[model samples]
Target: MSQNYPNILLIDAIPFQGGSKVATRTLLHELTTEHQLCIFTQTPQSWQGLNARFYPLYMPRWLINKDQGIIYFIKYLLIALQVLLRKPSLGKITLAVGASGPSVDLALYMLKPLLGFTLMQLVHGGVACSKTNARCLLRADSIHYLPSSRASMVAALARYGITDMMFNEPRFTPMLNGLDKSEWPSEALMHSSEPARPVIFWAASLLKWKGLSILNQALQELNASDANFSEQGFSANICYIQPKNIALEYDEPEDDSANIHWFNQPSNLDEMRRQSSIYVSTSQQEPFGLSTLEAMAAGLCVVIPSDASYWDLALIDGANCIKYRPGDSQDLRQKLEHLIKHPQLMISLGRHAMFISRNYHAEQVYLPQLQVIDSYLGAGSSKAQASITGVF
Candidate 1:
């Protein structure tokens, strides 16, 4: 309750744990130093800290339960308005959303005038893929996008006939995702700064688009090769973690890389990272794969899916990281076998990945976003009239 500090409302609309949650917390960690923060999240308090008043959807009433909740979003919409409206005396109100969702974003947009707050949205690949995100971009006072996402979003707005307005201003800006090393579970931290064996790591919430099918088929081919003879088989264990329900229900492929298995997301991600020396990302539209960065930061030899979407990530395929064909199972299998055959390749690639990953740590990535927020919240700069209005 510092009287001198201004108030800002940070909203996280998704009701679960994911990359968006990580981004929200990382930004809040730094922003709290200068503002009186109000975080509205659906994640239970046990999962992470809340610096300001935390409003979650975990009420005792079954109707508000996250399982199939629609009414609760409306409830939260009201609560967000209430929070902003409650204190007219507080100076310089700002509204920041973790990721724009229909329920929260629309409601807040309608209330922006009544509540007297400037709006900012964090666009995490959603804008490039959906028209809804384009609307979110147009309505907001400012936008924070991943380095790869900024160009795509600007292009999207152009397609919507917003070319001149969007490019002329700093409305949409690039901001890379970052990690707080200390936020990871202490027990899951690697015992030594070296890689562990018997586990190769892959994870994605959206399995279908992330190329999980291709991974299985490729690993299946690898398993078949192993079945032909003991000498031809692959080495190393692989663990794939899919966020529950988001993944397509895939039956276990036969023998099929019998070493590879999928499980619900782990409570401690560091433990998952520690148990593996190699990490692979099969996502096709990965604007900023936060998990990929985490694996690289953990010193894992990371292989990224070969596709144009990955271009801006600044990953060097042959040297710093490995790039496998987008959907070619055979190509993936060959790459896997090569890594299995050459242990030194894993070490070298892993070390380089770790070195390259330094440029994207939270300390480095979140600075631009902070500067944007600070400028928007500053008294004189933010008073200019918004060119775009009305949600689509």
Candidate 2:
């Protein structure tokens, strides 16, 4: 590590194939341009060519595995000391950490000297909802929230007397959960974009909170609707873009919608973008809807379940995007049927979504945020000094 550049340590579960991974990578790359970055991750397979030192903990494969394995338990204990020692000897050393789930948040918090380093807890929703997140926020030097628009986590922490410090206050900054626009094909490829059928995209892990089952039910309800049935000459042609296994699991059932056509596993990102006209996400407790951002970047109108925590960041009903009642199949059906029938509306929404997408570009959203980290690191540990008042 260079003596002039502030050395910052980032801790999170890696093997980053999802939105969290994308956001984390964007921030790391941004900071590395000026600061020294050291990363501690669960898996470092996907990290290549990044100017950062990586340490892998080798965590469990799944949520369930975290509870049963002796190796995981041992790894947890070792990670605490390893992470604790990452603090710099002089100036300010910053510690940025997050858990894939709530339990890990508590575990991460329990191991520390809060004052020796600037402690920041990054909450991505699922883990933030639990008692563990509450405890970590109460104990940490600062908290960096993914969805800055909401007062939920901030309110919850305030109730416990954990008010925001200057460095740790909640922010509405986008987590840089988007791709580099230049990496995509030219605008000419966008000319052929048209809704051939009701092409809907769902890109998320096959977890219960993702609401794939709810999406399936909503599609069935749309098929059963008299208005939707009569509008399409009593025949609805709906195409679903998802993973192969999930498509097989949900599409093969006897009650599955006959109008549904499944396109599983697009060869690449362009293929995935081309196969769909609209993007839909219904996660129950998303911290930041990265998939929605990606879809919007690909010029698709986004329809998100109203309950997702991150929706407050940019989504507005019938404005930039549309929202359905969370877990309400009928509401989702209504939204989908409307968009499918009104291609003009879809086009308008897609255009608006593209406009909204620009605000979240990694360069705009991430670089500025990383500047905050740079400021903190450059100023050194004085602002992070432990409060003597014992309140806030």
Candidate 3:
């Protein structure tokens, strides 16, 4: 409700790499085309193309002696007052909190009464699953977006009465829980003229939740089968040969079986995409499976774990991609065999996946957010009401 577009305040913690970064950055980029936008971030300059500056929440202590408790509180209070003094007008102030950080959320709440602003939280996985996160989110005015697929998350939310009680009307805005599309491999990188090995790519943080152990087991099975093929008169070329010595961090296994390649760190996103044929995800639970999307965009056929509630974000067990039971090494091994045996099928799947990924582009996602902003401004809730109730 001002003559000018609202001045949106984007409050986020530093290092915007995951869901929080992508969602917030996309929205800000879109809104800046028309609306006035200011970003307050811990890492102000890291993210490109933003009107941003570092916001210091604590004052520097000039005294020789250290301060604690009451003095610390007083110093923080001064910082809060400084932030408050710069608050945009009632209608112009729309604070968007992306992370589930309690301190940031609470600070936004304290500002609501005085600023007469609108507050929105870009909800990801934490709020719907954790009671503590749900309670923190109860302080916001609107939930702009979510990482969960519409069906599964809505059904789960119904159990908690979040459908009807949390807000006047809940809107399930779908968002990818994975990496930013901008970070995906480029067209040239995906369709390089240089031939790559028949790769079964598994890229992640190499942590337990990512299912590295299961992947290792699958590799063993693939190698065993490759050995059997070689014994039965199959040429070494016909058998899948997994290249070792791919990782600089870890030692090359002395006996890395044929058809099992282990990659550690990739210099860039394109390199990871280029050196692979089929990208497989072995995560026990992935809210949005960002790596899966990135692989799809890179034109790599994907085989993902079907255990997560959010697995439906990109379909599983079909033409576009394959899905095995989460943490099931046997299932993954079988899928890998199918892909290697029929490389053409894998290529087709990769093409289809790349086509489907076009919808997730930043330009398209940003358009819907502009609609949300228009709706919020039209409501004319000048009091900055942050009652996070649900609507069934």
Candidate 4:
């Protein structure tokens, strides 16, 4: 193995779409400056000076969903075959990062025998039980957790009858995912002694897991309350920023449209979040809340589920943000009402939220990834090989 910078194989099954793909692009843009990076995808992506980008055999274009699930796994498998055919020499590539977790796992399963590259599985603690997870966990040379709690991973591994002691070797890289500071405001806006605008802003994908139904129920109840003074020319106090709004988007039986605004995704989300007094997220078991982080950066009182999965990302319910019971509209309404009545508490929590969010900035957060890469490259194949293969 040469002492020069080791090459890296970076594969995100679905490129040019979604949070995971966007995260892939961000890391590629950052890492390409120093390390050579080769990305394999069914989708074409252009990155100047990137080592290589390959588009292997894939399903027809029409079949590709931006939210493609099982198809992504198949694409990764095909890409793996193509990469294996390339026949990378021993020590040619020292490390590989799985940007698209499930898909990458399938690819690495096939590629492990063909390539000696150290495999790292990027995880958000727990994944839903699947054949993909069972296969991938066996091949990961190292586990790189993104704001993933060790306890959760341990429990997840236990599902496959894999004990922690099996991979007790020094083979874990714990890091929080990075957020682009530029997307957020320069500084948190100070709360004035005057009251904040009586507005609540929410942004999320219109999905059941996102807990929109619960939020809609809360709004339905809230709109029935005194906040329904919109008839007196007051603007809707609840503005839901999703392409397809919740039930309140269309005319309902109670005609609650006046009290709730169903707006499309905003062009300038940061500015929109700043204009609002509070930002709420109802996602249950969210891996990492990027939109929630943006709201925190904007100095808005951010509220989320009490059992939000990523607790280690400095999310303390009453300390920096508010946590309401998941799927309980009554509890959500009560939490928001408390913030409405206590202006000082809102300001205090918002300020703390912004402070906590700064730690997630790309500069502060991505360092661990870079370090993990460097350490792997520095150690080379013989000495620092992780137990990428673990038997049950």
Best by TM-score: 1
Better of 2 and 4 by TM-score: 4
Per-model CA lDDT versus the true structure:
0.60, 0.56, 0.54, 0.61
**Taking the tens digit of each residue's C-alpha lDDT, what string does model 1 give over 85-198?**
645544456655545433335555656776677787776664443454466567778777665656667666676667645655777676777776455322213225433332
Give TM per candidate.
0.76, 0.69, 0.66, 0.73
- The per-residue C-alpha lDDT of model 1 at residue 310 equals 48
lDDT of 2 by residue, 1-392 (tens): 65666656665543334456555655454444456566676556444545777776544344323433565455456566666565454235555445333344444565556535555555554433434445665676555555542355655556556664423444323243545444432221233655446567667654556667777788667766775463452232222333221211333322324555443333365565655667778777677777777777667778887774666455788987888888888888888888877877877777787766666655555544455565567643321222323211
Candidate 3, run of 10 with poorest lDDT: 233-242
Worst 10 residues of 2 by lDDT: 383-392
lDDT of 3: 0.54
Q: Is candidate 1 or candidate 2 better by lDDT?
A: 1
If ranked by TM-score, best first, what sequence of candidates would result? 1, 4, 2, 3
- What digit string (tens of lDDT, one per residue) describes model 4 on residues 1-392? 24365667765554233445545454444453345566656555423334454535354554344224766666556667667766553237677877756433467666767677788777643554544565576668777666544555655567778777754666766656656544445343446445434567777655456677777787666656675333431233333433221222322222347646665544565655666667788777777776677777777788888783674246888899898887799998888777776767888888888777777665456655655666776733321132322211
**Residue 345, candidate 3: how far off, in angstroms?**
1.8
